[model samples]
Structures are given as C-alpha cells and as structure tokens.
Target: MATTTFSKLVVFAALVFVGQAALITKPEGPTIRTRHGDVRGMYAEEGAIFLGLPFGNPPVGELRWKPPRAYNKSWAPEVRDGTVPGPACRQPGCGPNKIDYRHTCNRDKNRTQSEDCLYLNVFVPRSVLLNSSLRLPVICWFHGGHYMYGTGSAMVYDGRILANKTNTVVVTTNYRLGVFGYLVTGEGEDDARGNYGTLDQIETLKWVQQNIADFGGAKDKVTVFGQSAGSDSISVLLTTDKTTDLFHQAIMLSVPFSITHKTQLEAIRVGNDVAKSVNCSAGDMKCLRSKPADDLIVAQNEAGKYIANPFKPLELFMQWGPTVDGDILPRQTVDSFANGKIQKKPFIIGNVREEAVLYIYEAFSKPMSKLELDGIMLAFLHGKGPVALHEYNPPKASDYRPFLSHFATDWVFQCPTRNVIRNAVVNGENDVWLYVFDHVVSIKSIWHHKAYCQDHVCHGEDIPFVFQTPLLLNLSFTREEQVIADTMAYHYGNFAHTGDPNKASPNVYTTGNVLKSPLDWPRYNKRNLFPNMNFTTPQSVIVKDYNKEKCDFWDKENIYSARNKGK
Candidate 1:
C-alpha cells in the first residue's frame, strides 16, 4: 500500500509540473496585426501580457522634430524583444529630478537618451485576451514629468496593477520631451516648432485604434487618463478638435491650463538665450541642434533663474508647456471649453484639498503672514484682495498662518477643478461628479518641515491610493484605508469601461452627511454647493459650504489679472 501511494504522488507531481510548463510556454509569440505590420508579443505573467511596439518611424537625424510620419511598410522585420523597455526621449535630468531641480545644469544624465523613443507598452489581462469574446476597455496613460522628463518605463506607472485590478487593457507611451518636444524657434525650422509632444501622443492613440483589438480590447472604448502634466495633456486633448475621435472619455487628475502665447514665446526666448550662452548661434537652428544635449540642458537651467516659476514661466525661459500651435492645439484649452467646443464626454475631475501646500512646502520653509497672504491674494486677484479678505479671513493668531495655505489651495487647484465642473454642467454637455479627498494619513510627521499641518491632502497623494499600490512599495494602510482604495479603483475602472461612472453602482463610501448612493451626489449647481462628497472616516456626505464665494471671487480676479496685465 505504501509503494502504491508513493507512485501516485510522483504521478501527481509530474502532472503539475507539466501543466505549469505549458501555461508558461504555450502563449509564446502571440502575433498582433497592426496597421504597420504583423508584430508579436508574449505572455509576462498569469494575468498580464505586454507589447512594446513602435507606432511611427524614428524621428532622428533629418526627421528630427518633424511631425512623426507613418511607419514605412517596406521596412524589414525588426526582431523586437518586447520584454525589455525602450529608452526615454532625449531630455535633461533623471528620476524625480526629471520634474524637480535635484541636479546641476551641467549634468547630462539624459544625453544618452534617444529621439527614437516613440515606443509604447500595452498591458492586458491574459484571461481577457485569451478569451476571444471578451472586449476589454483600454486605459492609455501619459506620464507626467513637467513634459520634459519621464518615460513609459517608469516602475511607478507599471500598468500591471491597473490591468489586474480593473481587468482592462492599460498602455503607457514615451514621447519627445524638453527641447526635442516643445522648442519653438520663431523661424520656419522644424526644431523651433512646438506641440511635437502632443503629436506623438496622437500617433500613439492612432496605434491603439489599429492594434488594440488584437489584444482583446475595444478600439472604440479608449479612455485617456493622466495626472499632473499628463492630466493637463488630457484637458488639451479634450479641447482639441484633432483628437475628437481618438478617445471617448477622459480622466484628468490635476489639470492646469495656465499657458498663454506670451508665456510660451518667453520660454522660446529663454531657449535662444541658452543657445547663445553655449556659443551656439541663436538665429541658427542648425547650430543649436548640433550643441551637446548636456551643455544645452545646463544653459536652460542657468536661464531658469531669470524667470518667475522657472518650470512654468509666464513669459520667459521658465515656461515649458504645451503651445497653441494652430495645427495641434489650435486654441487655448480654457477658450475652447468656455466656447463649448470641447468634446462632449462624461468627466471625473477633482483635486486634493491642499494642493498648494506641496508647492509651498517645496519653495518656503516658513508660513506667510496675514499681510503677505493679502499680497498673494491681490497678485492673483487683481485688487480683489479686500473682497477675498472679507470672505476668507485669515486666522486671528499669527501662529496659525500655516493654515492660511489652504487659501492658496482653493485659489489655485480646488477652485479651478470646481470651475471645470461648473462649466460642464452649465454648458449642458455631460454629467460631472465632484469629490474632495479629505482622508489624512498619520504621516503628518513626514511633512513637518513643509508646515503642512492638519490633514492636508497634498497634490499627487491620491495616486498611490487610486492605483492600490500601498503594499507593493511597503507602505502601510489600515483595513479602512484599503476599502477606500478598492472603492476608488472600482469607480475609476467603471468610468473607463463605460461613459458613466454610475455603472460602477452603489458608491458605499461617503464623508460628512452625504450618503453613498448611485445617484445621491447631485449635480453641482450654484444653488446647492453643500453636500460635497468626502472620502474620510465615517464616510458621510454633509451640507457644508467650502467658501465657494471666496473661491469664485479669486477665480474672477485671476482672470482679470490675466487680461489687464497691469504695469
């Protein structure tokens, strides 16, 4: 009897090994027929597969900076190992420094970067793709690193979590950054032209439309979502007529449409100044193009000191953002939205309660006084400081000035997000849902020096929660926090799958006195600004006005300041 049992066990073990081997090796070289050619990818894991395919011809040498052309059909079969990520676009800096100034201008970590970095990665659930009948929704992400740095290869943006949790196809692409992406030389030269980055994105969308179906995705059910500059790009795409058919829905995490023509030109002048300082002829595009990438990056960083908001200057070398090129952007995003020309689609847009706290934390060590706070209001509000003062009076105590940063929060981020919602409802285009993330982790000590007291939900803090990546990075979360992440991810996935977020059904989490129902969150009409949905402890919706009048006043004042340009 013992001998017989041992033989049976050995047979079972052999069967299990064979099944595992087959599962790992069976799905090898799955072919995908694209508009360009028949390319192949392979299975990466149990529920994930990746394809690193090129969507356009390499924009290098003579083709550099020109609008990306279609991939040539006559080209030979390039043996692509889709398992490896591609190089990022030629740009300055590395890692998070790609967005912030952690390195010197002389540093050229990205000198090895290639202009040929137009590759895109697709992450799909193997189960969905293997089942030919299942047509999953696709989420195409654009990474955010100030439009100058960041790549599809960044680990934080790995779509595995998104695909596994949401059961959808996820894609991330690399586009031109920095000088290669948005250097606008007033001359007719290709290098001087702006919006190259936007064009690269459009091309990737085109690729999705053509090849996504092969990966068991509905080409028509594409939802473009992004954060920070990526979110800014989504806003632009929604406004641009050229991208109307490329996507059906958009999720903008933190959109900022602060760029104007005057500001963009100033940025160009900064590039020219850098060129001249580096001994390259400012007038000669060829000479500037020939300069070493590192030297040019150093010059650009040196020139940043002369402009306010060096990363996003109003009218100088500091401005590095999308331009209203007549072909790609055609007009400012705000103007297009206000004119009711933007794509009519359901949108889910909101910001952290304390966004400016992050910026203030990075810039200053101390809090602002009531007088200094009034000055800031006046600067953004164009003499409407007194009205703002009446609405949002500073805390009486000087020690509580740190709390005043919330005023900056509402003025810059929260207010603008609410404005977008208001405009959408007022225009009668689509339904809009508003959320205020008030969940404050006990990590306040981590931000002690930034003066970010209270439960200041700073910018970009919601990303990890939304992606459900707390454990992957060894971050701790309570059972309740895990529930919030699950709920948020569920809603996001449902939104991408369908035009309406209500399809997710029964939003059981609420803050304040608000109840979690499929239709309880009313449209944000002016009459009822209370009952804003809060994501915090007890999860109840409550009727509390978040000083909307003060926020609106600041918005109008900023618009006026933008228009009048007082000397």
Candidate 2:
C-alpha cells in the first residue's frame, strides 16, 4: 500500500510540473477574420501574440500612386503565419548614417521592390486574451523618421513591454514614404494622391476594428500615438474625417498642428529637381514612375546635398510633407481645427523640456547673443519678442547663454504643444492633459556633451522612458532612472486605460514631485488664462502669464504674412 501511494504521489507531482510549464509557455496562434480573408498569427513573447498581417493589395503597376485597394484573396493551402514583418514601402534608402539617393529615379527597381509592404503588426497580451476577462485598450503607434526614414520594425518600438505592463494591445504599421507617399500628381484623379502613407495608416486602423477582438481588444477604445513627424501625422489624422471613429484618443508628442505643407514645399521642389537630374521630366508622372530605383535614390541624395537644411530644410521650395489635397486632407490642419471640423476626442500632448536645443547645439558651434535670441523668439512667437524675452530672459552673466536657450525650447516646442491644448479646450473638449518632461538623464555623451549645463531633454527623450525601454538609451540608467521609467510607463498605461493619466495605480516615487502632475494644468479657453505645467524634479503647475506683448506681435505678423502669402 505504501509503495502504491508513493507511486501515485510521484505521478501527481509530474502532472503539476507539466501544468506549470504550460502556463509559462507562449500561447497558440488564433485565426482572425479580416475584410479580405482569414489569416493566423503566432505567439510572439511571454504574454503576447503578434500577427504581422497585410490589409491592402499591392500598390504597384497601374495601381501605383493610387489609393490602396482592399486585399480580397484568401491565403493558399499553407496556413498563414504573420510571424515575420513585411518589407517597407519603396522610397529612399534608410541607411543608419547616409540617406541613399538611388531610391528616387528607378521604376524597375521600385517595382522589384517588395510591393507587399502594406502590412501592420499587432501585439496582444496572452493574459488579456486568454485568462483575463477584461477588454484591453488598443494603441496604434506610427513610427517617425521625418516621413523619409524609419520602419515599423525598429527594435526601440517593440510593444511587448507596453502590452505586458498595461494589459493593452499594441499595433504598429508601415506605409509609403518620401515621393511615393507624398508626391502631388496634378489636378486629375491623381491630385488626390499626396497622402497615400496617411491612407495606409487609416486602413490599418480599420483592419484593427474588424479583427482585434480575436486578440481580446476593445475595438472602440483605440488611441493613436506618434512622436516627431509621426506626431505630425497624428495631428493630421486627428483633423481628418477619414480617421474619425477609427480612434477615440490621440497622443501627440513634440509635433504641432502649425507644422503645415508650407514648411515642406521646398523639399518637394528639391525632389522634383532630383527627378530632372535623372533625365526624368518633372511634368511627366509616367516618366518619373518608370525610372530605376537606384537612380531615384541617387537623385534623392543629390537633392539632399543641394538643400540647405538636409535634415530639416528651411526653404519652402524643397520640402516634402503632407499636402492639403481635397481628399485625404480637404483643408489645412490649422484651418480644420479653427473651424471645429477636427474630431472631438480626448488628447494628451506635450514636448520635452529642451526641444530643438540639441539640434541647434549640433548645428551651431557658437554661443547665441541676446539679440540673436530675441530674433529667434520673434520668428517663433510671431513678434511677441518682448513678452518672450521677459518670460524667458537670458542670465545676466554671458556664461548662461546655454541655459537661456530654454527660450527657444518654450517658443518652438512648449508653446506649440500648448496651442494644441488651447485648440482642444476652445472646442470645449476639456479632455486634454499637458505635460513638460524635464527629467534629464545622466548620459550626456549621447547628446554630444550638451548635457553638461542645459539639462537638455532633447526631442524624443521621453519615448524610451515612456515605453519602459531604457536599454534603448544605449546607456545604463541609475536606480532612480529606472524608477522614473516605471513611473512614466505607469502613467502612460493609465492614460491608455482611462482617458485620464492620473488614474493609474500610484507608486511611491510617482507620488512625489518626480512623477506628479503639474499644478493646475487647466484647460485653455478664450476666457481662461493660459496655464503651464512644469514636469520638473518635483512636478507642479503654474499659471504662466505668456509674454502677451510678444504673443500679440507674433500673432499680428503671422496675420500679415498670411494676407501677403509669405507662407
């Protein structure tokens, strides 16, 4: 009897071990029904399964430059496995250092280029889909590389951590870039072609609406978030009617609605010039489309060299960006918001503390004078020179020029972000929360040594922290820094779950000034005074009296420029 009991006990132990292993192993792939046909995706990580599914037909041959069509054919005999990501859309070379110019001139190479690029990757936590009973929130992230470079496959944007931590489903997608995505093809049916990339994003969201439930996500609760140019795309999407009902909330990081096509006409002209250099007629769309891909890439490189700001050209004649085509974008985003046509949804918008400082620091090796500072202020503030000067005064000591660059930060990044908040508030959409990320990291070398004095929170510094991907920082974070990352992730996750970021489970560090919300970060209106939220060491809110005089001056100058067509 004792031997029999011992044998039974051993069997029970073996069964328990097997059950534990099963719990830890990745979940199985589930088939989801899409508009086109059914496709299956496999388990990606511990608590998530990612299906890199394609939604639209190949945009090639006669379909080139036209709106993407719905993919209708079913997969063949082999079971569909959305494990590997799709190729990026045909455009310029996204090399780590040099921008390849051969991408612009070659139609043959472009055709050979993978036409099956209209795909998106979805990440849904296994816990949320299989065990957890709750419907998870969905977040669709649009990658930013100036609308020129970047792909959805970048390691920094992996959604596994975000999904596991927030219990949310995350989706990131790839779309056409550069000329293929933004070229205006004249006033016929093609004039409607400027924003194919944006259209791709819209289609991806629609796909999620139809299929995300299989991954255990709430179709109605979707938020679109992007940084830099991606943020610009989010702003455009917010103002567009095509994306309405597709997403319920938006988070715009660093980019603003004021960034319009006027700032990018110069790049388009430069692209046109490059086409001409490659023996392609600027006026003949067919000729341009027929060129080899490598030649087009070379043309783009040549064009980049000719433009003054290769990174972000100041010339209007050589810019490349979303154009106000009557279809995708019926009107300018600024006009759309002012006219109240923009979708009325909750928004979370803010900028890093010292945005543009690193870019300027890298560009100019010299210190800026008071006059130069004021000039920049006037340019950005639209002539509100004195008001900005008063609020953001340079230190009396000449050595403080670096610190004084904060004026540039507030003018270019902070004020514009606030303007987005102001617009949302003016529309009576009070669901806007503003933040200023002042938590500076210790690694100054990554920022080219500018971190010594200015405490530069350069553009995009908040992304890794918010995503809890500190390892992407390329440097180790201190214990405190890790705490900051956790707090940031918690706050972001909270915002995703509920519209309010303050609703998250509070952490001890988060309760302190480090992660606390700014003081009185009130909604903007014509009547209410403009308030500034400071995300400093100890976060607090302060009602800032914007240098009214400088603001008025800039406003008047902008009005005059608009009347005179200086834009």
Candidate 3:
C-alpha cells in the first residue's frame, strides 16, 4: 500500500512541474500584418524590432531623381523577414557596419552599400505584441551626415533600447544623399530636380501614418526629430505645406539656418557646374542621366568643391541641398517664416556652445592665433569680422581654439537659430523652447573620444546621451553620464508624448531618474526675455542670453541676410 501511494505522489509532482513550465513562455519573434503581407520581427528583452522594411520602390533605372515611387505591395499573405538591415545609400566617408559609426563613411573600405538604400526601421515595446490595444507615441529620427553621409541603421541609432525605455515607437529612416539625391539641372522632368531627399523623408512619414497603427503607434502623435542637416530639412518642412498631417511636432538640433534654400537660378548654376564636370553637353539631360552612378558621384566630388559664400570665405558647405522651387519651397526659409508660412507648432531648437571646434581643431598644428581666427571668422561673418572680434574677444583659455569655435558657433548656429525662433514667438505662433548644451567630458576618460573635443562639448554631443547608445554599445558611462543620458531621454520622451519636454512624471526607465524640476522651461518671449535651459552635469540651470552681446549685434545688424551671402 505504501509503495503504491509513493508512486501516485511522484506522478502528481511530475504533472505540477509540467504545468509550471507551460506557464513560463519562451521568447519568440513576433509577426505583424501590413498591406503587403506579414513581417516577422525580432523580439528581445528590450523591444520588438522590425528592420530593413522598404517604404518606397527601388528608385533606380529610369526612376532616378524622381520623387519616391510608390511601394509595390503585390505579395500574398506570406511572412517576410525583417531581421536583417538594409544597405545605406551610396556616399563617401560612411563608416563600416556594426562597429564605430561616427568615423569617416567610406574611407578606403569595401563596405556594403548601394544606391537602392531607401529603407526604414521600427521598434516598439516588447509587451505591445501581447497587449495589442496599447497605443504609444512615435518618434521618427532623420539621421544627419551633412545630407551626404550616414545611415539610419548605424548601431548607435538602433531604436530597441529607446523604444523599450520610453514606451514609444522609434523609427530611423534612410534618404537619398549627395548628387544622387539633390543634383539639380534647371530642367524639371528629364533632368535633375532638387529636393528628392526631402521628398523621400516626407514619403517615409506618410508610410508611418498609414501603417504605424498596426504596430501600436499613435498616428496623430508622431514627432520628427533630427540633428544638423536633418534639422535644416525640418526647418524647410516647417515653412512648406508638404508635411501637413504627417507629423505634429519637431525637435531640431543645431540648425544652420544661415544656409538658405537655393533658388532655381542659383541651383541651376551649381547644377550646370556639376554637369560640365561630368563631360556632358549643356542641356543634354539624356547624356547626364545615362552616366554610371559611380562616375556621377566622382564628378560631383571633383567639381562640388567650389561653392563659396560671396560675403564670407566658408567653402564646401551645402552645394546640393533643398532648392526653392517656385511651387514647393516658394522662398527662402526665413522669408517664409516671416511671412507667417510657418505651420505653427511646438518646437525645440538648439546648438552646442562650441559648434565649429570639431571642424577646425585637428586641421591646425599649433595654437590658433587671433589673426588666424579673424581670417576664419571672415568666411562666416563676411566683412563684419572686426565687429565680431571686438564683441567676442576670446577669453584666455588654456587653448585658443575655443575662440575660433565661439565665433563661428555664434554666427552660424547660435544667433541664426535665435532669430528663427524669435520670428515664431513674435508672430504669436506656437511655443518655442531654446537650449544650449554645455556638457563636457574628458578625453582621458570616455572611449572613442575624438581628438577634436578635448575639454569642450562639440556639435551633436547631445545625441549619444539622448539615445543612450553608449550603454547599448557597452561603452563606459560614469554615474554622472548615466544620469545625463536618463535626463535627456526622459525629457525627449516627454516631448513626444506631450508638447512639453519637462512635464515629467515617474521615471520608469531608471530607479534614480526624476525629471519634474522646480521650474518649467519658459517659452521664448519677446518682452520679458526669460532664460533658457543649460544642459550640463550635476544639474542644468537657466541662464539669460548666452553671448547676448554678440547675438544682439548679429540680429540688429542684419548680418545674417541671405541676400548679402549671395543666396
């Protein structure tokens, strides 16, 4: 009798173990259905990631230089793999895959890339698949590489961590670049029409609107964010009606507003120069289109060097960018905003305190003398070098590069951005918030620290902290740096959910992270001139106009006029 009882007890224990095992589910990739078909995406503890999804048809062969063709969805209900990443658009100086992304793009490397690279990646919370009803905010980040370099798939921009941390859907998209995307020949249809890249961005946003709901994203709550050239594109979109109903708010970082959209005539001259360099007959659109892609890219590299600022000495800036067609762009960015063509939405635009240091620091062998600084400043300030020099006499730092960095930062980034926001505020448009990133880390400490930023925060330094990519990359982050990463992500996530960046609640991302400050970020006002946020370690503070005297001089003197710069 005892042996029979023991046998029954053992069988009952085995059943209980099996039942518990069934309750603990294993991790498996999820599949979502779209208009085309179903796509299987990778699932991790971080988020559900869908990668390498093409939103536009291949813009190759005859479709080159045209607006993004519609995506062909002629598939049955079979599942496609979204685990692999797509190739980045063809451009020089792009770095290798899965390693360091901020390096030179195609520097003597046999990297995997091609012209057919207009794709995007999406990331959502891991639990969204289980709870299909959970609708989250969306963030579409436009990768910035001077509009000529970079891929949305750079590991640093992988959206899994950001999505899981913020409880939002994050998107990174690829657009055409350089001559392939922006080469303009005065003629419209058969030849190069400009703004194809911007159009590509718009198309991606449209796709997000149409399909993001299936992936649990709030279609109406989409926000577009970018750095550098991406910000410039956002600035252009703000003035145009092309992006209506696609995205609601914007976050622009380090907007170089001084680079106005080129008019058709101005663009024609530049385009003609590129054509001539490629050995094509004048107005022979057929011959230009027939050339191989690489040959055209080489031609652009050879002749794309002579773009000049008539009033200044800045060269090789934006030769091929947003062109102001009479129909699309209509006019330069500032004119459109001043005429109240702005879409009237909440925005955040800012720049680093030392914006230009990263560009000029390594080019110099010795300390940059004041005379040399004045020479460089002339390129940006034009004939107003002396006036600016008198106003921003470099403080006695241990090094002199900061002075040169300061001069260009003010004219190109700081002052112009301030003027742009001021126009919005004075017009009684939607809210405008300003910030200046003053955070700095030591080169002796952080891995992959560029020689350009020794003790200073160069341009786009806020990206890593905001995305928390350093953690994803396993780079060492001190306690303070970790806090900074948390703070930026929290505020940015807040902005995507609500228009306000600092209306913070609990920090579900980290135990120690908290964002509700004693004071809310004051909006930009013309009368009282309230202070702006200073993003730094220990804690950020509000400060009244940084380099106020110089910014005032630049605005009052009208030194930033595109007419003077030969726009």
Best by TM-score: 3
Per-residue lDDT of model 3, residues 1-567, tens digit only:
111133432333344335552444533456777887778777555656888888898878777788898687646556778787777888875535534444323222344577787888899764464456777889999878777877787766777777766778899888998887887886745767788998899999999998898788989999899998888888888878888788999999988777666767666777777788878875567887788878877877875666533543343566667888865576778766666778889898898878878766755657876567667666556566667677776765555776676766787789888888888877777577888888885323332546657677877777776676666655656676776666667667778888788666342354245443344667777454646778777777777776677788888766666655622
The TM-score of predicted model 2 comes to 0.77
Error of 1 at 298 (Å): 1.8
lDDT of each: 0.62, 0.60, 0.73
The residue-by-residue lDDT of candidate 2 on 365-429, one tens digit each, is 67766677666545544444565466545676554346545554544456555555665677778
The RMSD (Cα, Å) of candidate 2 is: 7.8
Pairs of colliding residues, candidate 3: 93-104, 93-105, 93-106, 94-105, 94-106, 95-105, 313-379
Task: Please give the ranking of all candidate structures by lDDT, highest first, separated by commas.
Answer: 3, 1, 2
TM-score of each: 0.81, 0.77, 0.88
Question: Which runs in model 3 stand beyond 4 Å of their true positions?
Answer: 1-26, 95-111, 312-315, 362-371, 394-400, 442-449, 505-508, 511-519, 526-528
TM match of model 1 to true structure: 0.81
Report how far residue 508 has shifted in candidate 2, in Å: 16
Off by over 4 Å in 1: 1-46, 73-79, 95-112, 187-191, 257-264, 308-318, 366-382, 385-390, 396-404, 441-455, 474-476, 505-532, 537-547, 555-567
